[model samples]
Target: MGRAGPAGAAQESSLRLACVWEEPPAMGTCFGLPCDVDSRDEDSSQTLFFHPSTYGSKIRLYESCQVAERIDSFHDGIIFTSRPIHLHERVTLKILKKEGPWHGGLRVGFTSMDPLEIDASLLPPFACPNLVLQGRTWAAVLPDVCGEEDTVLTFWVDHRGRVFFGRQQGVQDILLLKGVPVRAPLWAIVDVYGHTKAVQLLDPTRLCGDAGEPAPPLSPFQSDVLHAPACREFHGRPQGCTEPCVICFSHETSALLHPCGHASFCYCCAQKVFRRSGLCPLCRGQIQNISQARLGT
Candidate 1:
């Protein structure tokens, strides 16, 4: 589909195809988010254009291709087409500018009908534009910064559309937003396994589809864990175990005090205690240091 310029001339010269194809929303449909679609004229005769077949029936047309127009605006503008469009679909459109290059770029906002129904693949490529998804409940760095230290920004969205960014560096250094409900489908699952940072979109059928159960709200504790830094080593494993206070039975009569104030215990006992209380069984202290023990004989 295409947008008509002033004087009824469709400017094909300025048409730059978007790298990714977006689904358009249907006519007169409530987007369920804060945005506005501007008409070419005072009269609302011009509907945002899109091919109903390829890009999906629903599409969100940006009121102006220039990013500054949508930034910080309480409402965003989009054209929703009523067809399922795939990646790589090409289309042409016009973007307005402020008469200078200093203030022009594309910006778009997103809010999921079901926050839990999001698919990671559907998320705009890392940093394409600022995204406000799940009722403005959660925010993440553009997909491009998936694995960088301090690159992720986790925040909570209140019912009033206000977002509270999470704090960094502390026991609660979690990057996942708190109090957000995982509705049904799990949109993004980030796996940080052994030097690999992979994000996978869940299948609707296995997650929020017919067979899936509604997701529950994230518990305060779970939120903390999700945002914590990646733990390189298994906390209490025999190999590469780094709890300094660990008490080694091989040293018949001495106990160690981990710098982080955890009780020292052997590999086997530490494992057992971690399973039971997830704390130092002997002193009832929270385990922090995970270094190996020195034999004090």
Candidate 2:
């Protein structure tokens, strides 16, 4: 948990977040949608170093979803991309907010070397082989998609190199990884997961245990765990059910289009996709609202 490079150095708080991870907010045209990108500064603290919490509330819904305060780690923690993405072209990333109190996590996408020493937040979750869990979200053509709430993670890379992923965990839209490999000079991977335990080192139950005990519920990285189990002795190649309704195939959808993160749709084609073009018919991206998910009784 100590990599530091881009002059970061700032780590103290096993857990404490109302907001305090400053520096990196000159972002306009984003949520406003339609800018290119300039102002340079890259360093990902070597791998993962995001702490955002200077007590937020510019009243954000997603002025465009750009969360970067710092991370250039000599250029590997890669962050920010309002433009410059070609190959199979198709980009999207949004998870604004959800599940706080710090369990913190990170592991976003895109990286084609050029100084990316590959430390995907300490990769170990199955050594990469494409993907398989979309409920808790974590399936990639081989890059791994994940979420706790407030999700979205679309990418593209077809012509034949095959790298397609569509995120959103709990209620569907899990098209996790499809061809895997557009590996080029591509960069922009927003990693930020959870973790910050130290409530008095979690009182050993209260002096040796249990005294009306409670503290035990951080909740956030769900998919349970079972990654990288194929371990090809010297080989490769190996590896969805109940999912229909990209807008009527006979019903069975639940709805979820909020912020351009497709959850498929069913409520009469999600109002017939906003009467036709609130955008997001797959990447038109621009649909401020349309949610309704929850059906797992």
Candidate 3:
């Protein structure tokens, strides 16, 4: 048997994590059950999810077209910063929505372990001491997240182990959950686990210190993941034209099938591609026009 590559590993991991919350978990202890709002014990103070998904496990992103297209019930996301954070340092996790608080939104917070760290199919939510899981409006009781058009959330553990939460409004926190010790590394969790709300984690950065100096207001980055790929895929290049073009299966794509873009074929192969078919080869979007990808200008 051959070892898995990065892409292979990612796909396998996605498959395993894509279904952590299919059914509502039973109260008290749900080891491998769906840990939704129903799974949350009204008496418990900490977060709990027995059937936890793995870190960065997303449903639609990995499912087959049939399942993904019809996935209108709910969605969930759990990811961490590319790097680990330190105590007393402010870290911001921005939730950028493609649609919005359209249906059921996200249940956002931090967990000591990744959702996939456990082997429980009915994995319940785990809360570290005094953990805080904030949605759109408030926390505790109703765990609905589609309260407002919130796009940014900031979290930081103070020197005394208090975790603070806030939105794009500013450095000032909208909700504060105190007394939890910053025991281990914290990973951000978003439970969109049964709604059509498409959410993406953008630009997780350490804002500043929480000691003497007050942190500055959250601002937009000059560029974002949209403009550039966070990590290179192969040969010091973006995930583009790195493999065989799905259409011609011939030469590497010399021109980009722009607007509905993918370098699926060479310029010669694309001359009549759109005239015959108005769809993209990669994402299957309607092709507005095909443009040549420039290089070494």
lDDT of 1 by residue, 212-257 (tens): 3323333576434333332232223354333322222222212232
Q: 1 or 2, which is superior by lDDT? A: 2
The TM-scores, one per candidate, come to 0.19, 0.21, 0.37
RMSD list, candidates in order: 22.9, 21.2, 17.0
Q: Candidate 2: which stretches are off by over 4 Å?
A: 1-84, 87-89, 92-113, 116-150, 154-186, 195-225, 229-297
> What TM value does model 1 have?
0.19
Write model 3 residue lDDT over 133-206, tens digit each, in one string. 22111111112332233345555656464556666645566434444323444444444332323433333333
Query: Which one wins on TM-score?
Result: 3
Poorest stretch of ten by lDDT in candidate 3: 61-70
**Candidate 2 per-residue lDDT over residues 78-109, each given as its tens digit:** 23232223555545444433333333343334
The stretch of ten residues in a row with the least summed lDDT in candidate 2 is: 52-61
lDDT of 3: 0.35
Candidate 1 ranges with C-alpha deviation above 4 Å: 1-110, 115-127, 130-153, 168-297
